[model samples]
Structures are given as structure tokens and as C-alpha cells.
Target: MSWEKSVRRVTPYVPGEQPKDKNIIKLNTNECPYPPAPKVRELISGLRYEDMRLYPDPEASSLIKALSGYYNVPEDQIFVGVGSDDVLSMAYLTFFNSDNPILFPDITYSFYDVWAELYKVPYKKIPLRDDFTIDFTEYYGDKQPNGGIIIANPNAPVGIYEPVSKIEDVVAHNPDSVCIIDEAYIDFGGESALPLIKKYDNVLIVQTFSKSRAMAGMRIGYAFGSKKLIKYMQDAKFSFNSYTMNRPSLELGIAAIEDDVYFKETCNKIIATRERVKKELSALGFTFPDSKANFIFAKHDKLTGEELFLALKNAGIYVRHWNADRIYDYLRITIGTDEEMDKLISFLQKYL
Candidate 1:
């Protein structure tokens, strides 16, 4: 009982279900249906087993170099972690130390609240508008002198994207606090807030390889910020774990970012599929927000989200569904390949 009292207790974030069967149609988690860049595959196959014995670079210089070359940012202004989740968690620990509650959307990424609670940091959930768009005025910090701001550009689950100009308005208003724009799905269609990083020292723009680069398995995510802001994150990361990134991830990440053409082609394919699926879903009497990410958040007119979710699951299809209030009737479906999308469309036609 004494040890139990001292143990940390908080509800952890539940990720989308990962089914083992290869036969199932998985559109639940927003993973790229295609394989990683060809160069990444070559690097993986060619990596030597003997190199595993040695510790990886604490600085992750090689991956940072590749990112710098790709994004045209200086090495001192970039920070890499195992994934965006790791990067965000470290940032929450590093920057959100003030007593005022941090601000985020009520229906944004579920991880934001989880991290806030885990760190015992105060936070306030500013509700999104009726149509699921962020009201930038609420985040101005004029009425509420808050600690920090972490916004998922094109906020997740809802799949609606806000413009970078609006994001800049928030950043400019909250000059005293750090402003983090979690751009995990930005590669799909949304404009990035990266340019703001150059103009505002408080802005930190985070992106990941999981969605567009098709390397979710490799777990490479990075952030761009001013030199001083990046140094704070790096210091916090090294203090926590000097070797957060391993050798294979570092080498493979370099290969992923190098092939620019393949990455763009892959994103284009997904965007095309998503648009087509949107029309088909509309014809079947489903309404959803205008999604800019690789997924659609949809609700059917005739059936509850649970009913459709269970039906699809029984038929070996998987899409994300949540029982939370406001979004309880919606489904978040990731865009798969043309063939895979066809299978999903066919299933809906017969089921409806």
C-alpha cells in the first residue's frame, strides 16, 4: 500500500488498435499504406549487425544533417526524437513549467491532455467552433495569461486544417509563451507553420516521417525552432536520455528524407485517394468535415458510428472510432491505396 501510494497514476493515451492479421483492411491508424522510400529499404537491408554493439550518436547529427538539407534549416535549430510523441513529451517537460494552465483545443490530439496530466502540468481545453475549426482569438492569451500553447495544425480526429496565418496570429500574440505547432499530418495537404519559426523565436514546428515518408516503423520525428529554443529541447532530451535515437533509425531516417521525388509521389497518391473516397462517402449519405490530412472524419446519416464500426470489424475492416462526447458518431478513416480504397467502398455499398 505504501509503494502503491508513491507510484504515478494517470490514464494513458490509447492508440488505434493494431491488428495482427495481414488479411484485414486497416485504415484505423493514419499510417501510409505504401512502403517506405526505396532508398530506405536498401539502407535497412545493408545495415551491418556489428554496428549495433556501439551506442548511437547522442546528438543524432547524421539524421539532423539530412533534415537540415531537406528543410534548409540550420543544424542548431533542429531537434530529432524517436517519434513526434517522444519529441512532444520532452517539450512538454521542458517548456511548460509555468503555473498557468497551457492551452489546446478540446477535440485536438488526445495525447496533449495525457502528457499534461502525466507531467502534473495545468492545462485548459479551449473548445473548437461548431464546425470544428479553431478560433485563434481564444489562444491570444489576452484574456487568459496561460503557460504555453500546443496546437495540432489540422487538428486530429476532426481532420480540419487552420491556415498558417491564423497560427501566426496566435504565436504573435503569445510572445511570452512557447507555441508548438504539431504538424504531424501537414505533408498530406496542409500548409506548414515552419516559416513562422524564422520570424518568431517561440514557435516550434514539429513534423514526422510516419505519415508522408512512409517510415512509421522507423520512428523518426523532428522539430524546427529558433536556435535557443532548440537548445533547450536538446538539453532536456540529453538529460532524460542521451541516446534517444539508435543507429538503425539514424541511418534509415537519412535515406528516407533523401529521396524527395518518391516522397512527393506517395503523398500525391494518398491525396487523390482521399478526395475520391470523400465523394463516394457523400453519395452514401455520410457527412464529414473538410479534411486536409490523410484521413476523413465521417458520420453516416442512417446508422450510428458504432453500428458501422462493428459491421466493418466483422468483415475484416478496421477504422478508428471513439465513444467520446461530440465525436461519438464519427469515424476517422485513413486513406489507403487505390485497391484498398476500392475494397472499403465496396463494403460500404453492400452494407448500406
Candidate 2:
């Protein structure tokens, strides 16, 4: 403990409990219940043993090209990393160098503040409204004083989405500050702010394959922004780690993006199941904000979030719960497959 006083001491962010038992129904993490695209498996199965000897593409060129083709953004404007966590962490280091406090929702991805603290960057968490909706006025670039901004479109845990026009307002007006729109769950039911990049050089739209692409284990995430912004991030990434994406991940990420039909199909399936579950939860006296992401933020009339979370855990069904203020009563349930959801609903019927 006394190794070095100079070593930075900081409390790290805790992730969702990943139970070891494979038999348990895990909806705690918002991972895609479906398997990765068939092409991903096919590509992995065909991976060459000789490929691992050398390092992956330092810049993730081929994967970036694949993303450019799929998202229709230029390659130079794209940047890929191990995951959105890595991308966001690098972004915080690269862009949020100013001494002023960075702004984000009080109840957000949690990692936002972790990265901010890890890098010793100043940050402020603006509280969401009573209904769990963000006040765009609080983050207005022109009206507010800020060093940087990051908003999760179709925000996590809460699962609510902000309109693209509202998001564009923040970007367009914040012409000087760096504005990042984290779109990890945009594939579920929200409109992406990706197109805004063309109009605003200060904006960066980050997306992850973990949710919709069913490649959480593969760990692929990317960002789209102006070439100038990407260039700065790219330089920061190389300075940190040249080869972030492994060869297998790069290949599989490309495969996942290529199967656009399968991608849409999987996302639609989750969305359909989410809508159906909403009705059933409502019948059980639960109320929640309309979710556009892959999860639902629900609170029951009688059942406390802690009670339900523990009860479900005892029953071997897992859902996410937070102990934070304003949302302590809510449970964040990931939309699993139809059968898994049916099981969850059936199990809850006894309590109803």
C-alpha cells in the first residue's frame, strides 16, 4: 500500500455483477441476446493461424473502411477502438483537457465520471428532470460555459431518447467546444445523430457493436466526426497504444457490419419484444418512461426496486439496478429473447 506516494490513488467504477453460472437468465448487462451475425462466426472459423503472429492494423484501416461503407461516412472521419469505453476514455483524455467542468447527465453511463476522474478532468453532472428526460438548455453550447460535452443518445439505464433536432441544436450552437453523442444503443429505436457530423466539425458520434451487433465479446466500437477531430483522436490513440484492435476482432467487426440485413433483423426482434414486455409490466402496476434503447427503466407500484432485484436474483433472473438518487426505485431490464422474456413475465405473474 505504501509502494509509492506518487502513484495515483482513485476509486474505479464498478460494473454489473456477471454471475458465473451459465444457466442463469442474465438481463443485467444490455448485451444483445442474439448471437453475432453468421458472417462473424464464418469469418472467425476461417481465421488464419498465421495472422496472429503480427500486430493488427495500427489504425484499424480495413474495419474503418467497412464502417465507412456501411455508415456512409468517410474513412478519414472514422475511428475504431477496443470498445466504447476505450473510445470514450481516449476522448476524455484527448478533448477534455480544459480546466472547466465537462457536462453530462447526473445519471448516465457511470463510466463518464470514472474516465473524468481517472484522467483528473473536471466534470459536472446536470440532474435530469423529474421524468428522466434531459434538459437540452442546460447543455446548450452557446448559452452555457463548458469545456466539453457528452450525451448518450437513447440514454442508457433510463432508455429514453432525445430527438436529433434537439441534439443538433447543442452541436450547431456549440461550434467551438467538442460535443460527443454516444450512440451505443441507437440501433434499438432511436434516430442517430451521425448525419450531424457532416454539418458540425465539433461533433463526434460514437457507436458500439456490443448492443445490436451481438459482438460484446469481440469488443468493437467506433466514432464518426470531422477529419480534423478524428486526426487529433487518432494521434492520441497512437500515443497511448498503436494496436488497439486485434486482428480477429477487426475481421469479425467487419463481418458484423457487412450483414446489414441480419443486423436490422436482430434489432427489430429486440424492439418488438420490448414493446410486448411494456404492456405486461404495466399490467403488474409498473410505470416507466418510454424507452428507445434495448432496456427499460421500470418501477413498480408496490415492489421496491431493491426487493424486485433481490427477488429476481433469488429466482435466477438478473436485471440491472442502481442505488443512485432519483432512480433508486427503478430497475433497468434488458430486452432478452422472446422465450427469455416470456419466462421473466411468467415468473413475475405470481407476484402480481
TM-score for predicted model 1 compared with the true structure: 0.99
lDDT of 2 by residue, 1-352 (tens): 5778789767898888899999899999999999999988888879998979998889888999999898898999999999998888889989999877889999889889888888999889989998889998999766677889999989877899999999998887777789999999999998899888888889999999999999999888899999999999999999999999999999889888889899999999999999999999998888999999999999987878999999999999999998888888899999999999999999899866
Model 1 Cα lDDT, one tens digit per residue, 1-352: 6889898889999999999999999999999999999998888889999999999999999999989998899999999999999999999999999999999999989999999999999999999998999988999878768999999987898889889889999999999999999999998888898988879999999999889999888888899999999999999998899998989999988988888899999999999999999999999999999999999999997999999999999999899999988998899999999998899999999999
lDDT for each candidate structure = 0.93, 0.91
Which one wins on TM-score?
A: 1
RMSD of each: 0.7, 1.1
Worst 10 residues of 1 by lDDT: 135-144
- Residue 191 alpha-carbon offset, candidate 2, angstroms: 1.2
